[model samples]
Target: MWDNIGSPFDYIAEKYDEDFSNSLAGTLQRNRVWHFLKEEIKAQKPLHVLEINCGTGVDAIWMTEHNCEVWATDVSANMITIAKSKLRDNSAVNCHFSICSFNQLEKRFEGRKFDLIFSNFAGLNCVDENEIRKLNTAFFKLLNENGRLTMVLLGKNCLTERFYFALKNEFKNANRRYSVALAKLTKDVLQPTWYYHSLKLTKLFSSFVLIRKRPIGLFIPPSYLNLWLNKHPVITKLATWLEYTIGSLPIFADNGDHIYLSMSKKITAK
Candidate 1:
């Protein structure tokens, strides 16, 4: 179902960590994700997790380290290969990796259920609202009662991106999120991407009740700015501080480069 988007991800599989996962901006944004992940995990022991678009399994490793049983999937075979290789040394970790696309979840894991369903870093943005609704229905059935779904999504308007691009006199790049566009994964690889407003995204997942949501890079900027931010350590430090200061404010919480949104399955009487 996602062959066009999934295959292009293969082009970046090898350098994904170097280009984004390990970049300074990526680290800060991910740290904020971890904060919410920990909060969800602390209440559920012997947790069972299903991660879609796992992307080399960094978060899968963290889940296993916390003693959670994890089944991580990505659409790209190259990505799953790297993820599986990374776990070879930790034979005891209860983590599994496989190549599966978002639309294939119900068919791929028919009888399986999970305590937590996770997708990070705008992976959910690969599809449109119709696909999202299909996913919402699948999630309702795949989740255990009270199970949680957490996603990190690119927001429609990013303050940092606007200022960053505007200063460069690049209005098109600054407003790219406002329209549908193909994001460049590599010089030759481009993938369709969609940006969402927090409320718009919440409405798409109608089956789940909102748990909490917050801005991820209100002050930290987007990962693409990592190179410049890394060169200015003091400015980066200040940005991180400012993020923690106001990232959670209701007024600014939904307007960042990315938004962390969590929701819970509603248990209805049979």
Candidate 2:
């Protein structure tokens, strides 16, 4: 079954609080996201920021609290509505919301260049590399000189790959039960739209200079394992601690599903 035919983002927004925003996995992973963003985000001069596929307002609210004048958007109206409701209490003059698709950013913002352009999680994965490249060009056009472009995406290979493979019944249809569980219980993320190697991504955005290449899920178990890990919170904590100890280490980190890829506009395009 195709994932995009329905309003997937809206479906997610409907359950964002239960599924992610407040769960143990969601709480832990979001800590990683905001911690990393704080270092890169600048709050000077009413800087403009654009969040693509800004699901359910989690990051949008966080940015507002941190002093960024955020112009948040999502393709799904449902998501935008829910996210806006979440922000009703905050009076951040800089925070705004809209509905716009990734391919048509200019329609929503005419001649507005942002100080920062960002997308979180697998939002960039909604389309394949062709879409990523196209968005990169758009990011180039919409950014101020020396602007930063950062995104967190799921890499092609991870423990999730094994899970997806089992669903595909690559090991013969004997694994149908596991596949059915993944399809019904979780987000139906089995149909992969975008997952790429770091080197390939570097080339895809070679126009921009990659400032940092590192892994995010190195020590953390993927979200799908949340249930199993729930029984062993201390052990999970220890395992994640061990994982963090090795986080700075090489190739192993890259193998995880989610990685943070950051870059800066290094050249003036002709």
Candidate 3:
């Protein structure tokens, strides 16, 4: 399954950072994710974190800077290559990069366990329902007692994307996120992707207790629309403020470009 989708990602690996990771909208959305991460893991000492689908290793680098030991893995070898290059300096020994998919976690880690399992952006959205369920079981086995799982996944309904496209009379594009679809990377390459609601994820990982969930791009526009937003800095600033303010409110939290969820493994009684 991974082999079929590897080409599209490998094609995009070199330009992924330039195209989204460092873009204005990507920076804004990721900053929101980082804020929650800092609040969750900052004071924890000697933290060991495992990041799945860690494209280009941006979040892994940030984790290491905050004194956490990080093992970042991605399915695409080219993506892992770019990530490894960014951390090749001897000083970044705390961070490690490998090529592995979400389904390969158990095989890769074996006896290892982490204090946190983190995945940013919409990496996990590439899989279907079954894969997600398997991931829940794998994550439970891979995490230490009371360990946490933090993910930023594409939401089922993105108000900003819907509104943006609807205004342009692109109805199908507006609603494309509501169901499973093929995301086209090149003329011939298409990757299957799924959008998930917060409730669905909570239920899928029911063994873990949900600790936090919030809207990430509710008011802020998606990365594809950043060019239009860049032309209007003041509006972008106000939208970002709104994003941080009302992002966690009910009805608002799950209606964004992506949803951020944090869940902790439940300790079982002996």
lDDT of each: 0.87, 0.70, 0.88
lDDT of 2 by residue, 1-270 (tens): 223434556555677678766777667666766766887785555567888888787887888777677888888777787778876556346678888889889666768888788788777766767877887788888888867888887765564445656776785433332221222323464433556667778888867888776666665666766776688899779756765666545465356557777888868658
Candidate 3 accuracy as TM-score: 0.95
Tens-place lDDT digits, model 3, residues 72-113: 999988888888888856426999999898878999999999
Worst 10 residues of 3 by lDDT: 1-10
Candidate 1 whole-model C-alpha lDDT, 0 to 1: 0.87
Q: Candidate 3, 72: how far from true, in Å?
A: 0.2
RMSD of 1: 2.7
lDDT per residue (tens digit) for residues 68-113 in model 1: 8899999998888778888856633699899999989989988988
- The TM-scores of all predictions, comma-separated, are 0.94, 0.83, 0.95
RMSD per prediction, one decimal?
A: 2.7, 5.0, 2.6
